[model samples]
Target chain A: MPHDHHDHDHLSASGHPYRKDNDGQLTYWQTMEIAIRELMVEKGELTPAQIQAQIDAMDDRSPANGAAVVARAWTDPDFKKRLLANGSDAAREMGFDIGPMHLVAVENTIDTHNLIVCTLCSCYPRNLLGLPPDWYKTREYRSRAVREPRAVLREFGVDLPANITLRVHDSTADMRYIVLPARPEGTDEMTAEQLAELVTRDSMIGTGLPKSP
Target chain B: MTLTPGSTVRIKTMSPLGHIRTPHYLRGKTGVVERVLGPFKNPEQLAYMVPAPTRTLYRVRFEMGHIWPNAEAPQDTLDAEIYEHWIDQNAP
Candidate 1:
């Protein structure tokens, strides 16, 4: 097993030692993840070339895709209106899904900003982006994030306006949230590709805003 | 409830027995034991590591209000399967 450096979700009840099946019986389910991999190789689930084809068919998972959609929104006034009206369909029009959840898109005007946290698990928009960072799933993060978002963001060196309303979106199930930051000044002359580069993951997470380059 | 000196109350992330889906967010925060729900399997089954490890089941609760005070939504209760080892009985 790859250990993978699992998170520290240890409860006070976690003091017990790991129990190993003394008789030595490995449950089939225990081996299922690897089993599927082996089966694919043995059964020729796809040829080496075909595997690439499958991968291509699947949409890329990353914020880059979201950046593209936001860029389009910035360039096209009509698209921005549509995106605000129908988040799911507007994102679909951009050839994307929120990835993990179908939560709505709410814009942050001059007065309000939004942030997201998965109080349950890291139920993020996987389709919109690839794997989340390692810190996202840590127990310390999960426990303390929403309770003290400003503090957490400060750890990342983010300084938010005290007067601006901060909304914390907790992802319970498949539902997700995306922040539409107030477009920065002086970027009106930039191209869509240029705009895409400005929208960082932190900005989308509601901790920061897109910067002018 | 084993009464041992020097224990504290906290929410457990995984059950030592039975099938449970413990959220990563609630582990290690202080919560009162409303009442015992009885023994259960460790769904967060550490015993899965050992072929058959003995584990007892209990129902533990943490207040949703305690988790998020400003929660616009109203859900007063949160319950889950708790293994004996996952909790420590601390002073109220």
Candidate 2:
């Protein structure tokens, strides 16, 4: 195995000891990440074009597309029906496959809510959302996401009472999730484009709800 | 002993049980013999740089609810490649 020259600096991004510069850069960790990424390219493990491809593809993230889906769902009941009937197909109809991921939606109601986690490793639906946030793959997230989902959700600003069921979704299988959070109030007259703007990635991931502006 | 060919796994190290690439989520869970597959060589030691004698590998299936009750899922099946060494008699 190729020894990671950035092993020492990687500790910062690994959630152990992170030190920030006055300008707020990860500094040493960033340096190491660049070095490691460059080394992987130099060794032909990954190419500069591949890195650029990923960068170019970043804006094409699934969350953004999911937001548009939600916007469409909100506007047209037929679209909503199609979405619920076939998650992956519905996403494709909107112009993309949630990727290789199997899209499963968790419907929320006045009485229950859903949250997702990958207890073993990060098994996110990259097709629909692109790469997952770093925090989603931590040991703390893996252990706690299953055991104390309610508590973890609270940290993300979701505080539901005991009467409201807090369902935790441990993504152990090939299946992945995208929470269709309830559309907030005052969006009745909003255009699809306007509504899509309000749908944040975190909200679709079930970490929060779209705010009314 | 049913892990088939071409499946991803999550292996861990053990003493008597030997090092198996079973995910921690299904560590103690028991799965029925879905399908008995070939005697492929274990990849744990190779992946982790142990360089030990190769062992048998198998594919196993587990219920999703069994792994995570809070999972908001419509179906209930998770198939994974598991080494025979990690299986315990008490698994069920």
Top TM-score hit: 2
CA RMSD of all predictions? 14.5, 9.2
DockQ score for model 2, please?
Answer: 0.09
Go through the candidates in order and give each one's DockQ: 0.05, 0.09
Docking class of 1: incorrect
Candidate 1 lDDT over residue span B23-61, tens digit each: 555567555443343444344445256443545444344
Tens digit of lDDT per residue, candidate 2, span B1-92?
33444332333334444443455666666554433434545555665776556445454555446667775441334445455666563333
| DockQ, structure candidate 1 | 0.05
Best by DockQ: 2
TM-score of each: 0.56, 0.59
| Superposition error at A175 for model 2 (Å) | 1.7
